[model samples]
Target: MKIKANLQNLQKLLPSSWLEKLQYIHSILLFRWILHGRSQPLACNQKSAMVFSPHQDDETLGCGGMIAQKREQGTQVVVVFVTDGQGSGGLETSRDKIIQIRKQEALTALSILGVAPSEIHFLQKTDGRLQELSSQEQQQTIKQIAELIKYYQPEEIYVPHRKDCHRDHEATYQLVKLAIFQCGIKVELLQYPIWLFWRAPLFILLKLQDITAAYHLSITSVQEKKARAIASYSSQIQSLPRDFIKHFLGAYEIFFNAEL
Candidate 1:
């Protein structure tokens, strides 16, 4: 009787045909909310965050919605780009041109997302060689981040996870961790995944922080930015797995609070 009752309740949220496909998801999210209770309402003054990206477009792919949501709430957000994306294009495209183009696209993306110019900081490292940085260089980068952490003193920081699939993303994650450890700041750390958004469901286990951002997650908006961002990479796009676009279409801000 309970099974039948539950099914009747589930039917209201989704079509009958989708019940089989969505049963686990619905039950898990339901159980999660029950255990986690509800997110406390944050006052506008307390909504500040720092976001670190391994390269251009990462901020968009990972935390764009969350950033918009915070920005609208007058939450302070600072975006730090770890690389200029020099290696993201083909031989036909000069490295200088590709970097400039990606920078411009990033700015355009920020405008669309409502992040201001003062909030962006570029680390200006070699695009594909972040992992190969000298130990001294890595320390220097981390020191810079430490200073930023001290200066901004954000209550939360968003970074790519150590388990990131890409070398640059993974390296940036490590660098941030070292910096935070060095600074001894007790700020909450949230990890956002681009390549690993759904590689594992466990990645989305963070306390959901929903603040109703302004972007219309319409197919038209997502597709337009997605195509432009993907096209910005002339040679790099084909090397991406076939399912990449489909994955980005999920258009949801996912996070994990493992460090918290």
Candidate 2:
């Protein structure tokens, strides 16, 4: 039977025990959702918070809701865009044009989130090539980030989670971590998952127990604003899959406390 064939294929792909555990986890999540509903809106109180985005859209995709909440609370939120995002605009578009478009889009998106133009920093590094930077280039990049951290003296820092699937995300994490260490500043580090949602669902499920302090900040009120911010990046939405944009929506944004 077709059903039996599918079951056999799934079993071949994953051990039966693993499948059972996955089912159990899914059931638990469903039960929790039914019983408790979603979490309530949580305020961000940091006097200063900095987000290091690997590309133009990562910040919005990962923490747009939190950024809006923090801005509403009068917290200074600085967004540092680490790359030009040239690789995201598809092969038809010229690299220079893509960079210009992505930057403008980022500005518009952050502005919609209530961030001032003065608070955004664009590193403009080569797109899709962060992992290939020379050692000197890497040090220079770290120094630049260190300077920003020193200047802002933020109380909270947000960056891509280390285990994120994208090379750029992983490189951004490493850069931020090293910069924080170089600056010798004590701050709360919060790691946000973006590409990990699609690429590493199993890893996330397995590591759920390792999350020390998870924050599911509700963005029901600002969901519209967040959606608008995401829409500002028209080029990305056109080039990338629709699901990529869809993943950032919903009632809440998630962050996990990370240790340096």
Candidate 3:
């Protein structure tokens, strides 16, 4: 926690752009080290899995490779987008239009990863404001997710990392976790990172347990498919920072195991 506090203080002193660049560089180095480090390769033996994304394109960004590999192995994979993506627009585009555009992009991306259209679900919750949901609204959202879990009964569930440096992502993790517990099921929970790479230092993000619990899914064989899947998010690629989306196209995707 002290490391995170010092980094937060340093962040306040540095230019925003410079700090982001530094974080990105450090993230890259950390990723490379993990790729070669002691983490074991993931075994794709699950009969079924579900991935929860806070936004339209996050599923592809964080779990695209694993999804692709699992699909190839004949594992049933369902993807759920928790938000409506209303905030992903510039001043020119209307909220509803941006939501529709992002939803279409998500469909195309997941299709490329071999997830059937029938298996993709959109919860249509408010974007960029998940943390602002009222107490009753929060329970309603959790109940909705719990219903889906009861229906799917997946052996494994994937969600954004708890400390992903984005409020929506953090909220998604908490919501999904509560839903899992509510359903009273024992399932493997895998947490993947997205914005943390560009927004946080590695030292501040890692806990001792996480270091030993890291898992790597090798996407080398399916990297091209993953690349094409990521490319389907043309809206994000054009609007986000230059090269920001490329970091996810690496040979491996990292996930950390979490329990209840």
Candidate 4:
């Protein structure tokens, strides 16, 4: 659990996907969580928190429960969508149509997570091309994010973690890393699961939820909102397996949020 442990060692023992996951967690606490020390709470009187997601539904699919719990604790949460997710072959015949659908879905999903419409920010980045952005563009994106960081000035910033099979997730992570440091804000970067990590069962350092503590949302509106959000991405449906969506459509929803 030593932060000083060679990255090459982890690289040898774990696949690239798993290694990327650890890199994110390590950034937050430098392996203290893995070493069995007690986890520290955020600064007292914190009111606002931010979540950065690559797609429309990821924020809700990944952390809706914890978001609700935090809101109940009197924290104001802002969920940012990095992309409209408009490049699927199946969801629709046109990109414009997909964007329109996704925007509505995002608003509905954020509402389910207890966020007001004013709290949502859409960056409108192209979905699926997040990593292909040029270095120059990436730098500019970082600078622009600094302005946003100043505006929100959230003490807790959650971004998609590395090891995501989806390119957008990785790009969003890189942007968040650069922006937070550039803005000189010492916010904790929490990772949310997307394609590759959903089936993942364990983490080397942190486990934010336990089987005993896992609770289902009782409000049927939350489930409906989740469904509406997922359905909003008409363009990306082709990328998802039919079986995956079939199994996912249910009243129950669970998620994990852990800082490295």
**How high is the CA lDDT of each candidate model?**
0.66, 0.81, 0.87, 0.62
Query: How well does candidate 3 score on lDDT at residue 5?
Result: 86
Model 2: lDDT of residue 93: 67
The sequence of per-residue lDDT tens digits that candidate 3 reaches over residues 1-260 is: 78778888999999977876777687787777776785678865656999999998899989999999999988899999999998884535888888989999998999999999999999999999999999999999999999999999999999998888899999999999999999999899999988766776565666666645788988888899999988888888877765468789888899988877
lDDT tens per residue, model 2, 1-260: 55556655775799755765654454345324422453333455655899999999899989998898888777899999999888885647678888888899999999999999999999989988999999999999999999999999999999997877789999999999999999999998888877655442433243544443656777888899999999998888887656456667777787767887
- Model 4 TM-score relative to the real fold: 0.65
Kindly report which residue stretches of model 3 are placed more than 4 angstroms away from their true locations once superposed.
1-17, 89-91
Q: Which residue pairs collide, candidate 4?
A: 25-260, 91-234
Q: Which stretches of candidate 4 lie over 4 Å from their true place?
A: 1-47, 198-239, 242-260
Model 4, residue 82: C-alpha shift (Å): 1.1
lDDT of 3 at 9: 97
Tens-place lDDT per residue, model 4, 1-260, is 46325544656789866655554444333223322243333222345778888877778666565466566567888888887668654574588887777788678767755688898888887888888878887887777777788898887777665555567887887888878878886676666545532332234323444211222333343456556656654444555544345334544333224332
RMSD of 2: 6.3
TM-scores for every predicted model? 0.68, 0.82, 0.91, 0.65
Cα lDDT of candidate 4 equals 0.62
